[model samples]
Target: MEFSLILKKINNTLSAEKELIFNDWYSQSETHRQYFKGVLEQFENNRITVDNKKGWERIDQEIRKKNSTKSYWKYAVAAAIVIAVFSLPFTFKNTPSDLPPTTTLEQQATIEIGSDKATLTLEDGSSVVLQKGEHYEAGHIKSNGEQLLYDSTKTTPNVDIAYNILTIPRGGQFFISLSDGTNVWLNSDSKLRYPVAFAENQTRMVELVYGEAYFEVSPSTKHNGSHFTVTTLNQEIDVIGTEFNIKAYKEDPIISTTLVEGKVVVKSSQTFKKLIPGQQSKLDSKTNSIEISKVDVSNEVSWKNGFFSFKNKQLEEIILVLSRWYDVDFKVQNTEAVKIPFNGVFNKKQEIENILKIIENTNEVKFEIKGKTILVE
Candidate 1:
């Protein structure tokens, strides 16, 4: 198969006959399979924008210069795949030499990456601080360090509903398994209010007071057709055995509900919309409007996967996300710095300094850490 045709096949743009031919070619040699794997990795890591002709020309020149005397067709093919897949043209200017030396001054102490921490408010208004790596049992609810789970062994009849709130502070995350077996993953600076034991034959309801959460609803069949509902500030999501993510931070202008699987109905006071898999319903808080759009479900739920996936996100927006995860304050010295757009994925487990370094390496802005505050310029 021609190298270009292989690229087309890799991209799923080839006919069935060509795909079969490409698969046969790949199976003939381990070198072909390895080359294909490398190409796939490059395509995932870098966003290639150059035209096909230019990409091939650049690859041909590089191969000729590096392996002129070799008769290695595999080497040539690998080189072409790498060049075609990973050629990102970065034009950002380097960091200015005249800028002040970056320093890490003491603000308080360096805040660590967010861990499993939360405050569980009981039905009596008293609270329990859930520490990392510690297990506790409160009534029918049991917590195993990272997650709070309701014991299924205990059964509750029709009774007055009692609610408890799990509040995750800045630089903290937590998980909870409701009495109905539904699971919720709460992000930093968030709160989930749910019943300790849901009443029999009643709707399983929870409220995301603020921030973000990813929910995996238990099948209604298991609960005698009891529906699941998530209440946010401006919208309500009705689910039936669905997995979805909701971002309704009070600081954000919109409440976004992205469905991963099954179905969800997003309802505001004015209107309602149903969402299928890979679709998102965004409710505008200001206008009280609901809009539906197709989205990359994985990107929307990347926080639950321990990464920050930014797609053309503004510097200020990125700062807000980082601030919550790192428990730091941000002060942008240059006004234009907040307007700068960034697009990339970064590990959420990294230290605040290391994460800032990745942004600084772009050379669009620099960062200085003063205690717990990050000054961006």
Candidate 2:
């Protein structure tokens, strides 16, 4: 069998399958190990542009020509396959809202919810301690797994509730369940505001003051009639019941709403667009235009799932996201560095230094962290 075919199988395998394939291939011969090393070196050196198939093809052909062996064809084909798999990060549609939007009930949104550390504030205008290793809960409110849950059924009757704001700093994360049974997962450096409970006959609503969040709204009582709406940055997502993710970070240029299930209408006070499952609606800050497109919802919501999945993301964009999560300041030495795109998925639990090391292995760039500052060279 050709090395390309072997690698194709390896790339597509899950953890256990990968382990099996690696063990089988590695035991085949010493030459197989050497070939694996060569491929690893190419990836580490950033010789492969994840989005540039042509550039990779050229490089692979050159490597084959220099080797001048009948086995060279396998290398070229394998390199192309590997490059395509890795380049998944950078592939993007021309428009943000190219994907179709959902029209069913069940609206969902994913939001970034924390910062460098998690803390809580009390109603007494005093800061309360939310130390790690401790869990807190009350009627309609519970927190576990670094997330806060809100169940509206437990609130006191016929009284306006005082809303408390929860802010998650960079490097910190949290989740929340609302009184109306809405669930939100907040990424680093985010915030959400909600009442202790909804008053009688009050509309179910929560404000995303900052950062990003993913929401899974409970079905409305009328199911066929009533609508649930979330407001942020001059935009409103109205739905009856849907699953979707919304990213409205203050620093980002556009507010992105990705629908995963049900139907949603993303409306700016002035304009509106409806989105279907597997499609996204984008609110552009500069032009103020609403763009729509089909997208892989999983990739957009990966952060909430404990992973940082980058698909054809520019080096600068990656750094920006990292800066927010790691709570570090970065200074890019060269402007052109912003144009360099790469693809990879990293677990958020990993140390910042480990990720930097992985990028440094790309050989095209190096980084040095001084105190709180990250200097990219």
Candidate 3:
């Protein structure tokens, strides 16, 4: 028997004695440590670890054929021991979907975005046809190829008076520039409202109606009340200068505020919380409560970088995010599957079917993709 098969058998064995011996040898050797490190490095860099392992095994077989006196069982046992030890922790890390049977339910819902085209609604309730262009300014606003820009000069009464609504369709995205020079990257199915210019004495405030957005707040050396504020649903975030991401979809139960830089004070009608970098503030709608916890910043902010990151996120949470990004509906046939958490990452631009295929590879879950609907079982 080969080392891999022997190790797999030992892992599945009900007898504790064999498992203990295998685990001990696995953890006690430096040779095993080097092998495991090599495997991990190959996997992390998107190299083929399984192929490399097979290549090593082929070399071992060739060497053994030349020296019949050498025993391959000896190396197999050594490798088996290490594999047994490392797999113990991993075997216990299965998601809820890997568990026993449970009741199932079917859900049907639709996702809607505020608008489809990239348009600007002026302060006078009129509209401006802003097409894809380079460096164009109307009043105190400007836009590049991908985003709109806002640049305003403070004056005695702040004569510049302009406000507009930027709407992104379900499958559309846009960029915007705030009067304070803050840059915003709005995801699909998102809407943002901002003034054309900052008020002379008022603070800068923007409202997010739905979906996700990343903000890089520009510093303000002038304007005593130069703070940046973002309002979503019933919660408000105040920041002096910071980089942050907010997911405040109306349909989702929890509103998330993940701080990337500086500080933000998230205030509700009756509660408030301060968050630092790498911290995520979660607000629950049902109870009107807020909770803060340290999170993996890269995992939370990866979407802004055009990556989908799932750090053991519940299947329900993953569905919510997908629903927003893909502008689709989720239909789960098994309620028990909601408890399952997935840990994975892929480019945001990848096809939804590709992402679902990766999830199905786990073997504990299956998916049915039909048009804009995803059915998980």
Candidate 4:
């Protein structure tokens, strides 16, 4: 079997027949087992000592070099091992056992992680705090702790359109179901201004004042073909029926809209772009321009599914996300540390210190938690 096939087996991407061939090849000779072990050892050593980008460059050079005879297979195996190890760091994987314990940090600090908490601003300007796991009812809207649901059965005659705002604070999240059956999940530090009940014979409109939100818009067919529009600071997303996510934080440098299903039209002051499923449109604040790209919809909507998924993201970008979710502040003492790239999948319910410790295990940097502030060095 070719070393490429064996490498595919190692990454668990091989067909069953290829896997059997690899197993038979491994058992054919003790030399093959030793070679595999040596390759793994070399990969581990390089993972710790070498820069990731430089390692890939070396692998590229090896691929360009021509080799004849059986020795070529050995080089191919080595190159494959290096490629696997480096690429693993850019993809989400299950947390391995035998990682460092989180007891010390948990015992020393008194920090509260963000949860399902939000403030609801009623149409009359009265604000109510929605605590975690607490049920609340006001007008036709009902909250069963986890999400707010509207009872469309208790509709009143249209007088004037009444607006309500759902504000999720730092370290908090929330969910709401509108009377029109549209569902929204608000991320930390997000504010959504929407009507208490959409008016009849009018276009449904809402404003995402700031931060991130995932929307599962109800079909217009159910509402007499009415259109739903979400207006952000930089652009507007018009939907007939679609599931999408928008990140428009006031402090962010770009406003991003990612479509998961169906279709939508994203309009800015200068131009309008139409998005299909699995596409994302980003509005750059500096240039006032819109750019579109294909994206992994699962990664973009992972937060709403109770996981933190990162792909080739910088340490500083990850830290900013953690700050909002943990309601903490970060102070980086080393400027270079912020530029380091990371990729991982973490449970949202994991302890803040435990997550930081996992990053520390990379040995590229360290973190010091002082109260609610994380000092990165």
Model 2 agreement with the true structure over 199-264: per-residue lDDT tens digits:
555556677777888888876773334467788877888877877888888888898999877888
Backbone collisions counted per model: 1, 63, 4, 1
Error of 3 at 4 (Å): 33
**Model 4, C-alpha of 336: deviation from truth (Å):** 0.7
lDDT of residue 120 for candidate 1: 93
lDDT of 1 by residue, 66-146 (tens): 764232232333332333232222221323352223344333356888889999999999998897878898668878778
Per-candidate Cα lDDT values, in order, are 0.74, 0.64, 0.64, 0.74
What lDDT tens digits, residue by residue, belong to model 3 across residues 35-151?
A: 334334323433212232443355367546765322333332233222222332334344445432323323333333322236668788875544455445666666664677666
Compared with the true structure, model 4 gives a TM-score of 0.73
Candidate 4: which stretches are off by over 4 Å? 1-107, 154-159
Candidates 1 and 2, the one with greater TM-score: 1
Candidate 1: deviation at residue 315, Å?
A: 1.4
TM-score of candidate 2 on Cα atoms, chains taken together = 0.68
What are the models' TM-scores? 0.74, 0.68, 0.66, 0.73
Worst 10 residues of 3 by lDDT: 76-85
On TM-score, the stronger of 2 and 3 is: 2
